[model samples]
Target: MTVEIRVSRSPGERRVALLRDGVLAGYRVERPARPDGVGDTLRGRVVSRLPALAGGFVALPGGESGFLPESECEGRRLPPEGTILTLRVTRAAQSGKGLRISARVKQRPSGPLALLERGPDQALRWAAAHPAAPLVVDDPAELARLRAALGPRATGGAAFDDALESEADSLALPETPLPGGGRLIISPLPALTAVDVDSGGADPREANRQALPELTRQIVLRDLAGPILLDLAGLSLKARGALEPAIRSALVGDGLVQALGFGPLGLFEMKRARIHPPLHEVLADRPLARGLALLRLAAREAAAAPHRVLALSAPAPVLDAIRALPGALEEFAARAGRPLVLRDASLEEVSDA
Candidate 1:
């Protein structure tokens, strides 16, 4: 199978499209440099606890508030609201929340189980299936060991084949030639992805209002081939048209496609292929925790015009690159009439603040 990968840049973000047999198999959008999220270990103070919810709120060191669900509140002592608690970001932002885990002790399985650690997805071990397996409370490691020692003998019933068939059968895209399209946003969850689409100008005045974004999103999903998520938050109901096709697409193969009317804000909603962050977006903006104040500057001269001066400002790397361009300095001098000015700072310093 030949795979052709193409990377293209747009005004605000970069796009990556993978084509197999002339079909668009995968697409990724990288935003203009940002920060990484999740995976950070933090020590937070319990702001409050809810016995009913079996959870508490934590004031993270940097002033971020997190929820520690009761399922994870295993310690004997229920730390008072102000008690300092340690935790880590397990899953990315989901349903307006971040998944977390406490640093307290946990559990695991103990040997040969260790050797079969990779096949849990294939196991049929339900609570009732393996009631005798010792819950060797310790850490994540021990949990894996115990599971393997006595986990179902990898007896992948029809369920396993069904899941594999679903994954393999869906996500099949088309070879339609699309214009320069770009998708840029934060990395979605690893298992499911939601996609939202906005048309350039689908106006009803011209009679081209083909369901506005709802239709646009559907077109994108079919064109892109893969999972589709439409997160329309402010669209009108009548404009949604019928959602049967989109819904049908979504339900296929474990819902590779999901469509809905406007969201809370009236926008379309759907799901798409669950891929990791696109290469470019991952390289530039991984942990999106803060902002960047880096600066770049450039001076340019015009050949001849009413206004023959130009001055540019941006970040340090951009400034350095601009200055290195041939005739860049002279052009800047002539165009700006006044020398271009620049202030440089480390990318980290600019964003960390």
Candidate 2:
């Protein structure tokens, strides 16, 4: 029942992984973007309205567009295309998805709109809100940031080492080992995620009984949302009937809000509202986002690097993202009191920085 939060510097972003009893149950990648738009009020122009979708797209001042549901605009007049109005971001931008925006009315809002934190900050907030757990980070600077985010309750140090890094790498794999030699395979598609549970020849009921709690843990850990279909390996009608109650109890026990039931074809169906993008999506689809993340990591490493110059090697896309944020990158270098050398990809094989 022990929970551990490991914060590490990953290419172009800060990666936070949650381990329950040493098993990677959940993870998040935090990267800065053009104001993730969540919980922030901004002026935007109506780009287009889609009656079929029950919403329209609004182009924010920052040039990115978000979706405005008709429900949110019920009391307000529907502004025409190019009409400017202030709105708040209900959901952040993600892969092939725009922000979920809601209408706002503040005739001369006093100050800048506040933004909701995501990734590392969100993870810290979650850790602080939950049962006390050891928070581990690889960098002293990051540790300080965690302290600032969590206040006095935060207590941890630079505990991430080579061995833990390897453990993290293994834990990140799609296929994860379950207790009792069973395995869980998670496959994500563009529309939804599918989790296949293999009981490994054990009693289907018993194995599933043991696996449901861990499954819920994974769901929370991965920040998985929307539709999820769990394909448990074996189950008879009676077993399924028994499994349903167990699954419900597990989800409730974990304090997770997911509608659970069996589907038409005997597959276990689950649906949870999307609050944030999963770890893979943030790291894979958002290159520029990751680039900003890398810059942030560089700023942190700059302080500890033995030399004044910090060497960084990452994919071309990530480097491009860094270049896109020249001002931020320069500021990061200034704060670290070091110059950064972006390693050429040809000279060194590259992955995420």
Candidate 3:
């Protein structure tokens, strides 16, 4: 088996893609300045309690808050508002939702909040552990960091350009086309992610059989978590029986596979360990994409007025992201042979950018 790693460096974010036999197997985005606090432990105070939902809110030291389920209370009395407690993040915040925390702290944490290594680095170590699989990074600096982090297994000089950027974009697509004229529609609900399997005029069993491997790869690649409902088209008892084994075979060696069974109404139910939000929500939760869009616009506008001071305006979040990247704006301005000015404005001015 051949494994290839592609690392793409952009301002404020670094994206990693893993390929197995030329197929996209894994994808991750890391924003060093702003990390997803998946494994972080925070000292928090109970801010709200809801007995009906069996969950409540905990406010951390930095004014950030997370949802605390009753199960995370560990049989202790439900703390009233303003009660102090320690919590570990179960799932990072995403799509405007707060972090998911629990009372169970696996290790002693440091600071008011403690962070663990990002997912890409964790997966890089996993790849490096296999001696034969070569690791590649596009940036020399990134390659050096990985080598230091994972010994000599890391290597440099992989090609990454707009085509690879497009390939990375495809990983987060909602509708995934399958071989043999089938498709999988992945929908992220408030509770869990739902994947609808469509045979697309092909036999349901055959399509499902073909889709499982790719679907399994996507599950790991996208880092989708929590309960997953696979709605197989025209599922029968016999076909369902066949699929259980097939699904098991597909998921073999993939990390953190959980309960697998058919739920009410024959929906194939499965779960994956969720440490962080999936790629879609990760990108959505940050202003990196918006900052990139604004840079693209700056590129275009710079060409039109090479010597003029180009003014770029965006919301506070986007502006913060743009400025977070060292030398990015200055480099662009230098290339344009002009000065660039940044402004804070509503997204209306920056949406198309």
The number of the candidate with the highest lDDT is 3
lDDT of 1 by residue, 1-353 (tens): 54443333222233334444544444443332321234455556677787876777766644456677766555544567666555555433333344354535323322111111111210112223334322221123323543465563222211112332232223232211112232222223444444443333343222223333333433433332223344432335555444435444434533344444445544455554322332322333322211111111121023233254433434566656544434434434443455445444565466778
User: What RMSD value applies to candidate 1?
Assistant: 17.4
lDDT of 2 by residue, 306-333 (tens): 4667777777877777777535566565
Judge candidate 3 against the unseen true structure and give its global Cα lDDT, from 0 to 1.
0.73
| TM-score (C-alpha) between model 2 and the true structure | 0.74
Clash pairs (backbone) in predicted model 2: 11-353, 12-293, 12-294, 26-221
- The best candidate by TM-score is 2
The true-versus-predicted C-alpha distance at residue 41 of model 1, in Å, is 3.6
To one decimal, what is the Cα RMSD in angstroms of model 2 from the true structure?
A: 5.4
Model 2 regions more than 4 Å off: 1-12, 16-26, 33-35, 74-83, 104-156, 159-171, 253-256, 285-305, 308-337, 345-353
| Candidate RMSDs in order | 17.4, 5.4, 5.9
